[model samples]
Target: MIKFNMAPTARKLVNEVMAVKPGERALIVTDSGRSPTITEALAQAVAGAGAELAIVHMSPRLMGGIDPPPHVSAAIHASDVVFLQLSYATFHTDTIRGALAGGTRTLEMWGFEEEMMVVGGANVDHAEMESISLKLTERLTRAKRGRMTTPEGSDISFSLDGREGFALLQTAHGPGEHCACPGGEATICPVRGSASGVLVSPFCIEHKDLGQISAPMRIEVKAGLAVSASGSPEGERFWAILDEAGELAKNVAEFAFGTNGACRKRVTVREAKKAMGTCHMAFGDSQSLAGEVNTPLHVDMIYDRPTVWLDDEMVMKDGNILI
Candidate 1:
């Protein structure tokens, strides 16, 4: 059994950690490689939360496979909340999806947050992150009234009045990595991993200037997918990465509303966009681990300036939500 120690980062994760209440159970699921670190920190965290916790720890080494066992079913059934982590050599797309799919209806899942962390980021201020995340979610759910678009480049454009214009979208299904698999870059789970962006139509435009942009591009979304994109290599590369994900590559999967106000881009995707306090959408992978499974392709498009409308109500214009 690998043992994990509590460091400042671990403490921070727990500090902002919110889960089901006392007497309720929270399960931390992960691959064997991440089990030690995750389990250790979580154990300490859960105890502090006054929640009962149990471990159904599984290792890929024992079976030479990554998926958790079907036999582990009973363990999860007993918990009120399921805290899952996948910090391994990636994971079998199927294995990850199954766990999420099976748990959603089964567990209460009262509070859920998903995001990718790297190089042991212990500096994350959990409270600040959660505040940002919740604020983004809150703004998205509000309704809005907006202009129109006839995606698919149709002969006519219809107004987005009384339609769910912008939403915190999750693949209405399970996850498959390729959808947003940016080749040659370090990645988190390709599927439902991060609560990164609140999805926008390729036709929708959101703009922001946190640090710099050689030239910010304006890409177009049609039918919930990016059809036309124009910008620097960084901007276009965002699309190129998805193009390689295969057919249905541009099928939008997840839309995350970012709130990591403190994170700065590594000047590379792995360190950048995912941490931005804005909104984004993925084309291919829909996370199954997060209980969403639909498309195999998940690509994310970040919004800098957006006007959001849910149904016929106008909620946000240029990053500020009326809610």
Candidate 2:
């Protein structure tokens, strides 16, 4: 059992960070690897929101593996919205991407830790888990394309397509509604483009230095897949660790946006990824929605800001969400 001393603060983190609204029944996904203090406080906020909350706990042992708890599949579909805060589960990229695209919205919260007498019971990366939904779906309705700048002055585009793209891919894709995982397009998924969906941050992970990067990370993707991955020794080291995962290495695991205004990558993935004004990418099964995930291996890369062009329109420039 895990426990923590409660900190007094506003209960609705959903509202403060992502603006979760009423009439939204949120599925609160966490794990034994998550911080008990955060969970306890978040639960109270959900209730205060006048919204419904459902909690899904991923098996602790499986945190580093490819498989996910079966319950997530049903809960994602049943809920009006979802809230995720687990690092490992975020690799389920398919679930986060497909769920939001398919009409299930979510609030992205990652890299949160306990303040004020917090005890570690589990690792819940809410930013890694739910933030993708906001990043991917924000443009879906109008779906424009735009360029954003990276800290290194690199440019990238990010955005979604009009309603048509979502419909075609969901219908024609092999998994169809099931593209979130391996069973079908529903179970596992691949990148299907319309207006240049999916965006990644530029942070590098290297051997024994996941905390800091000696080399800069450059990443590019189209639709929903990563097309190119680059970094210095830091980049190679990151992939080197990821390569050990076998089939999981084949996957371009994560696609994330930053929220932590105070964070910047150094040694720990949490701090680097949670650093404000950035985002990260992963290549693997996407426990958030199992993808190339067969083994449990997944990796994340963070970059400062890259120009984003979604559907030939500009949305993010210089590491900023234009929406």
Candidate 3:
């Protein structure tokens, strides 16, 4: 087997996706727990693209969606483009929202490992992935109701009224645009108080320490709130975490489909949720994604081979995209 280098992928991110021009100010926000090798590759790539580079290292946040320090937020707003190379996600935080609103192009690489740069999703054709994502986004935007079911007993339905779908693609060169590295998903916020039924997840990405749960975690939702959790010890722990996070944490927030064919099954959270034919549902912090709910946490639950329906149209059948 040949060893793959990360430099080429880093270069593609800087020159192709972000389109960092000469004299442009590029900022890289990383944390102590993140991979230094990945950060350095991105830094070198930015420099080679003829952009002024600045890197800021901060203590990692305890959970996803937490805000960074004020100075870091300030630096993000001041830059032309920013690379979020952190251990936990800041994509749903007000800090990133402010920066994007101020015309800073941001790329989120939360929980990204060095292996992600050379293999898996990053190794795929970005343009083809983007096309798949955008097409699904269009279908989602036009949908008013959606339902999903997995072989492991996940059956949930939610209204998509007035919601717009967001396509997570690699290109984010324009002002106020945001994307994720190794991105390929179409996501939308479900209407508040409109989700109900059971959500059974084979993998809870937030509790990655547990890895693939021995039993599927089952969550019962009523009126869009996850009323109770059961089915396994992991499910109980998941409920406890949400209970500790306050009432808003139980709100069913996001419904998304993975579109990256090269993404592996059952890997890290960032990559697993992008695996083609898979789907993930998230709870908490929908404000940044064009929804009303805002909470201290955002967690995703991934399940395999789901059959999904959007307004009577079968978009996915057993994890295969039909459209």
Candidate 4:
């Protein structure tokens, strides 16, 4: 038997970060594809915190937004805190929505592995991460338009008009407030049909797969739709995934700047997406980000060494955040 050690980060997650008090029902929602060791660690933490722990296991979903078993949904709504430790996310499902409606705080740890619990962004100072994310949100909210460029030939522009960006903090302290653990970022939804230009990806996170861009892969967006992808064999895979998602797949769904100071590159997408100085471009599902575009999929393509400008003001230059 492999004995997986629980790191202090796991302890912080249950005790200080989430504040799972005694008597609170902390529910773990998982699937067969997920790591049992990670699950046990979380369960141990919940137990140590004096919170009643109940686990609901289900089969993995083929795609995001697909509903979990009815019993699992029921458990979520009844619990005080819900932890999603699944291979594929059910975040967009009505099941989770209902739980949030009923005021159950959630932490979506989609695609999280046992190793992640032991190290990486999971160990960061979450309050400081939140503080950074909040500051980025303020700046992003203040900007009406933004442009991103890279030396590798990525140049994209989009309108931030009337859009509000938000921080994904590790702590969820209030009703109706949920977060993703190992979280640190400010994300926004661009106005519909407002994005255009070429996006050169440095790395990508597709469903359960994370890959480095070995060759130049550029997605061409015109009026917020990715009409074509070019420059590498990976482009074919990207186009196919988008095409498989149906017409809504073309829509430029989200834009975000990573704010987790402790995160590094080439790790899980959840951690990489929050690596300070990097940014990700997501396609499909804008509803969660307060935009109109809605789709079953939300795929993020991360880029390294980005130089971003918000209406003539440079905010990020070469993978470094500037105010």
**The candidate that achieves the highest TM-score relative to the unseen native structure:** 3
Assess every candidate by TM-score: 0.45, 0.49, 0.95, 0.92
True-vs-predicted CA distance for residue 315, candidate 3, Å: 1.2
lDDT of 3 by residue, 103-174 (tens): 999998888888888788877788789889999999999999999999988899999989999998878989
Across 57-167, the per-residue lDDT of candidate 2 in tens digits comes to 775532233334456756876766566655443433445555656666654334444541132212224344234334444453344433445556454443322221111
lDDT of 2: 0.46
Error of 3 at 186 (Å): 0.6
Expressed as tens digits, the lDDT of each residue in 1-323 for candidate 4 is 22355546567777766778899989998999888888888888889889989998898876455668888888899999888998766656677777888888888888787777777887888778888899989988988998989877889999998899888888877776688877888988888899999987666664554366667787899999999987787787778878987988789888899988887677776677778878988888777777786576777788888999988899999988888
Consecutive 10-residue window with the lowest summed lDDT within model 4: 1-10
Instruction: For candidate 1, report its TM-score.
Output: 0.45
Q: Which candidate would rank higher by lDDT, 1 or 2?
A: 2
The C-alpha stretches of model 3 lying farther than 4 A from their native spots are: 1-4, 207-211
Which window of ten consecutive residues has the lowest lDDT sum in model 3? 203-212
Give the alpha carbon lDDT tens digit for every residue of 88-197 in model 1: 21222454445444542121111111222223112345455545445545443332312322222211112222222122111111221111101011112222222222
Cα deviation at 63, candidate 4, in Å, is 5.3
Rank order (by TM-score, best first): 3, 4, 2, 1
Comparing 1 and 4 on lDDT, the stronger one: 4
In model 3, state the lDDT of residue 114: 81
CA lDDT, every model vs. true structure: 0.38, 0.46, 0.88, 0.81
